[model samples]
Target: MDSTDLAADGWEPILAAALLGAERAPPGGPGPLGDLVTEADPGSALLARLALHGIHHLAGLDLAADAMEPVAVREPAGPECPPAAANRLYALLTGGYATRERLREWFDLAAAAGMRPPAWLHQALLRHTQHLPETVGAVAGAELDWLARACGEDPAAAPAASDWTEGTLAGRRAAFADLRARDPEGARMALEAVFRKEKADIREALVGTLWTGLSEADAPFLEACLDDRAGGVREAAQRLLPRLPRSLYASRMAVRATTALVIESKSRLLRSATHELVVTLPEESPALARDGVEPHAWEQRGGGVRAGLLRDILARAPLHAFAGHPPRLWIELALRSEWAEPIVQGLFSAVAREGDPAWARDIADLLAEAYEGKVSGLRRTNELLGRWVQALDLLPEPEWEARVTELIRARKIEAVLAILAKGPDSFSERFSAALIDWLAFVIRGSDDLRRDLAKPYVIGRLGERLWPGEDIAATAAALAARLPEEEGGDRLRQQVMSLAETLELRVAIRREFQP
Candidate 1:
């Protein structure tokens, strides 16, 4: 370790000579390398030996190894997202109000394009989309460690087993609902674990989870709940039990329905019997309340409420208990019944809840006839008329245009808007075109309608509800362009232009997610 020895391997002696001009040390390396300083080129030999040995000196230096291996991160998978599409999602995460509001559209487009959020956007998405595990898992599988940690810290982040015992009420309900889907038996045990001790909100939400995947398996549990003290739990049970036809509660309702309502027929000479529905309000039973019938008089005044009680009861009744006929035939006959009011209401309720396509079709056909006046006896007020229009949505999408077009050209503004309101925020292209055509019709019609459509609030609501497809917007703009540029057209023109502009902006927002 002499200072001049310098630890330069066997070349230290040569290095010393180079620096201090000490006696040229004898070559100590093996064989030809030891004889490196030949008389032919001693200077180059020394430099060459120093250079080669320097690499060996560094390699031989002692160093500590790493204490642990680096944490493994999931490798991101999926096609690369388009630059523009990823940017829009970035804007949303970075506080772009316009883009954030259309998350559903962005999701649809992102899914269609088969690209997930880029790795860099993962953390931002985790913080912002705390509740959307599907989005997190879907777009950023690599970020699951972040998501798992997030769910642990915040119950509202995602459903978990712990959610059943603790965390936010919403988290508990979400956990319970998720359990209902994956393990109905486990969910029942979870619900039963806390049903007696939890407050009404918790109890209610747990029972309500039965709404999906409702089956006879849940019947006994729900039937026991009907006797619970909490109205929420009882009401949830009441609502769900009726969907299971074989439940004892349904059987009781069926008995009551058959007894209270009978189809009486009168004989005719050599002709078919004239059949009609004869509804006689049944005597009240304590079991009625237990079975979800509200305790209200059969004839309580303001028209629909008291009758709604009966409607609620019959809603749970078996379809066959009402009559031995298709929904349309029975509903038509009920329209002529002495007690048409409650009977018709109950029949509609039953059909709506059942959602049998054939029954839904029959209901839609009959209701459409009522709407068109081809069928009579079902009297409707303005409010009922609005509901009737909305009900037409049950008809398949193909049949919608003809009926909707007839309503639009007829200038049935309230009814058309009712149908529009009932529709999904993003309408089918054909429906959007119809809406645009209606907008044009309204612009050309009366001054009052035109002024109403021009209002900021009305137009804003439309922008919120309607999908802003480029074609739909362009069609509307063309309609505005075609109108004569007169004083009467000025305000209406601006309104149409405004709607078109709104649609265009939304279309662009959607396009940001597309390739």
Candidate 2:
């Protein structure tokens, strides 16, 4: 038989003979194959037969079928990215560690320019969205789905509405939060549907998520949660319910608070006619406890729960309840009250949560005093001041900006830096630019460059807005010229130079990505 015929029949016999030995079971048949058998032994002869068969089998293997099917090609939904844009995208992927802000800008520029990223880079962009989906806003839906499918994932795996029940606690919370931002009622319904089956921890977290869209509409549910067996759930309800300006809990708290204080305006003649506003605090009501005015040790130190109950009432009550009563009146009343610290603390909370810029600005002196250490010896004052700076974020952007500049000019460097440390998310473009200009002006006008440049990093960030541009060149050169001969000066100059380089790179990147 030919090698192919022999192979098709069975190569096992030949292999077995090679392994065992032809002496054990010899092939008695004589042919061309038998004549070619080696003289060494049965094993060697079998080896020769197997090698020759393999060669014949491979040589005679079939090449193609009689008829071939046609290949199908589909056009992509979008146009390919321009050569320049594609190169930039490739650099961002391989360059490593581009900031989320920069990545977001790149995605925005590419989409706006109608450039679809190359298919090869799909994996790269998809991998980036794993950590920060916020950057996905600028990425096109078609590209995103295509990339996901290419990565062997379902196109709808990262659905617009996530399956909240399928992930870890943190992951589920994140999903719920995202859903809450998009559809508050839907998120609430999803949580409520599973509430009975959820564990205590999850119930607490789901309740907390209501803060994303807290309103009078949510009051019925939050009020129901007040009776929850879980302390965390009940506490979250207590915290969030009062934030709703028109909620029953807020209204109840406001009524209870207003009743505790009596504000009277009297006109009396000392030298001439003058106005005096008097505020009086009455005996504590046992009913206040039900409105979330429970006494805490922090407040008890001032005197007792009775002495501090007014502050708790003020805190829980909406600031709008006191709309007609001026902030100066409240300040004056707080100064006169036995529970001044708690009262002031409550005012900060009210103004902050209520987002009353007028009241917030009115309390600027109190905030500054606390920050300057004049009013911070007490733990309550220190804590309230901490909250005050945070509440500063809720102030109208322009007002907050003015306050920041005021703080910087007053040389409250630590306090100004503390506000700055809250990050760019806290500062508007107007505030950031103005603050940087203020800092630069402060540095340039100062005779002590050595001291002014002590915090080069902060200076560097503020200087980032102007570089490779003409505006910053003079300031940078001036700073460099004043660099001391010591190590500190050398460090300062290095930072200044680094700031310039960063700005230069940013400018070039902006140009490269321009539509």
Candidate 3:
């Protein structure tokens, strides 16, 4: 009630009686004392009424009602989330450890179930999802645009596409590719018109947009880019040209690759030939420069200029141009030449571009053989391991899993990471079950203090990749239950217990979403 309402409700009269001496005025104003029948004096009655109204006044009895009506939220068209799922959301929101990740799970489940968080959580949910860009589509179907708008966000609206030229370099690059997809010719023309006017970096980035609808159609325009003022632009064109078949740029690269290295084999009678590479650095020319043979003037870090040139040729050359050698033979030759780094980098790029599974496998196999044994060449070993991972990524799913298994047996921590990698987007049930089993063994029921602090990180990365089973939670719980018996075990026990809770909560989350 407002001050006026409080006064009008007989408080003013009671105040008057008190001020003018209640013995004279007889404290008879309508108040909490009105119904009392005892012969209590008016002063005592005043104290009684004062006690009642003081608490009421302190609790906002004098506050006026708000003038504006709150924006009424529309009732969700779909049913509200089950109380259990809502509880799960509240737990994730209020608790620590993989909160956002678990919330992502809840968002997916709720969106798929065609349900929304209870009205009370709408504000919190909006605030959280707004900050997590990855959660954009996870809750898209949750129908929370009205809530977003009430919070001053126009979630239902997208900005109109501005003219590409008017946008920042990054924005233009993003929009140009989209434009290229929609109108390839127009996008090229747009790039061409601004090619001379934009900064070298902008020109280079704009040329990158050609990668979107890259084909022979874009080759002529890209070839013209080879002679652009910016060397970056020329190199960008050089990289893109090889992606288009039968382009003169690719043909030039093929000729370079075919002639760049000669294999001379020395053999004994009735014996296998031992091959050696006859490689020499060719002098630079305008043609080589235009094709980005030396992409930069700075000397290559891992290999010299010649090695860089060879890597470029290998990256762009047609597979058949390298003496018809198998991937292994090619790798052997590169290794013999001591250009292994260049070759690996180049071949990895080419394999990805061509999506040649056979080449990827052979390259991965050769690189992975005695991979960790290169202790003397740690940097080189890491580079090669990374190459193996990339190549394996390109392999078919079953083959990828098989290789992951092999890596796990080698007891590679990197392998474990690859196996337990945040997933369900690509990981299979068989893969997850085996990996989780491996994790329990690897961690040794949280007894592995060497890997102690890392437990949460690994477990949190699960992203719901586990197979349908309550075994992991049970194991963690049992370990947590027993840890207190050991000295200096509280922290480890707590960590293990959290893992158990996360797993159990995940199981419940999955259960809540099931039909």
Candidate 4:
């Protein structure tokens, strides 16, 4: 029959019977097999009987003619059959049954015939058969072997021993490995005894199967196995133990790395640069030098003058740990190192925190020198400006105002202007007024500072701030007086006019700020 014919006529009857068989099986419950039985309805039992006959016919076997007679017909007068006959009938039905439902019916029939196979029937079938063939000999052999094993009569110790071999053990092992992945703990329990007593090679094979299920909970078991006589088992456990949480080694390392040292500033300039100059070292000291002033310097020098250990200590200490410490100490150490890049980075991080600006400006000048004539100057400028903007917001208005005053005092008009330009919108108005006043001061001050103040950045910052609703014309007029008679002057004036137009500020740029 074509597939459609098989499904519609032949398969439907077979399926119905299988369903009834499932419903009759022991341990019945609401499972897929139960649902099948429910759906088949009405003629399920009849379908099951017909399906059992069909399976025997398909397998080229026949029910024992006398055995086929109704049970009532043969029960009193027929020749008695051995229990083996029931198993033979079951084997034929199962071996030839095409669907799981049909096999289930055969199982039900065997149970009813007082020939119930043992609970391990499925496992036993899977264990013995290498190949299933249509021959009656093969079928009979499988059924007899199952019967012999299930009868609590060891097939291996039978009078005529079946030829089971080492290959059977190999097959079981392979099957268990596959099952382990699906249900790790179940598989482990199945092999637990064998795992402890198996030969070295076999034990290694079993442990390898367990790697997928290894977890912290399994650590104790694995730990106990660490001293396994087999090298492979020991190695496997050792490899897995370290990856568990709360490992002993990691805790030990963390504890050993925690000591603190105090580093004093080396240079007289840096020592007097700030009143407090103590550097605290924790277990995680930065990979830089740590020397500073020793408290007992005179005693160490035997009451005579000697060189300070600050430079040597700082040179030898780790530099990373001081990254979040006080800025003054970092700056002093950085300057002592002649502004090494690592020390510079640490200083930058410290300054990035909102702090007093008198020191910040001096550090800025030092940074400016460090950055001068280098390709990275613009990057460094942006980094410092970004940090300065953040610090400005955190400090109170008065503190920011004091910082501006410090910038002016240090003649750092360009840096001051940069800071004002990048300051957040909340501080824009205050910075704009302060910037104009600073510019005026610079313009009217010593010629040298005025020349420095007239750089493009300063002028650009001033132009950017002269937005609409401000007195742009007056600011432009003041700026014009400071413009030099050079090409740079023309560029500055054009930038100022562009800024005015973009911001919609109605300002007249005089000929002076232009060139």
Q: Among these predicted structures, which one has the highest TM-score?
A: 1
Candidate 4 per-residue lDDT over residues 408-439, each given as its tens digit: 67866556756665443333455555555666
TM-score of each: 0.70, 0.63, 0.64, 0.29
Predicted candidate 2 versus true structure: per-residue lDDT over 1-515, tens digit per residue: 46665556345456666676657855624665556665576556666777765565455456334213333343455677666666776676666664554565566666666666777777777676654335354455566675555444666444235767766666677778889888998888788787868877888887898788766888888878877777788788888887888888888877766776657666666654333334345455545544556767765577666657767778788876777677866765565555666677777778777777678776765556555655523233545555556657657766767877787667665566556543344445455555545556655554454355556445556544432343444445555556556644666567766655555455555566555
| Cα lDDT listed for each candidate | 0.68, 0.63, 0.66, 0.45
Rank by TM-score, highest first: 1, 3, 2, 4
lDDT digits (tens) for residues 1-515 of candidate 3: 66696675656656666677757766454445466524477677776665655555455553335423576667565667777777777677777554766777677667667666678777666656544334435454345677775554667332233456766777777767778888888788777776788889888988887888777878898889877878888878887888875788777877886677667789889999877766665556777877777655554676677777777777776665653667876665665466667766676666767777778788667666636553223244555555556667767777777777776677676645533432234456677666655655665644553254355555554534554356655665665565554566555556666666767877778787655
Clashing pairs in 2: none
Name the better of 2 and 4 by TM-score. Answer: 2
lDDT of 3 at 411: 68
lDDT of 4 at 283: 22
The CA-based lDDT of model 3 is what? Answer: 0.66
Candidate 1 Cα outliers beyond 4 Å, as residue runs: 1-71, 77-80, 93-101, 119-127, 130-137, 141-173, 185-203, 270-272, 282-285, 296-301, 336-341, 376-384, 396-418, 446-468, 479-498
lDDT for 310 (candidate 4): 32
How many pairs of residues collide in model 2? 0
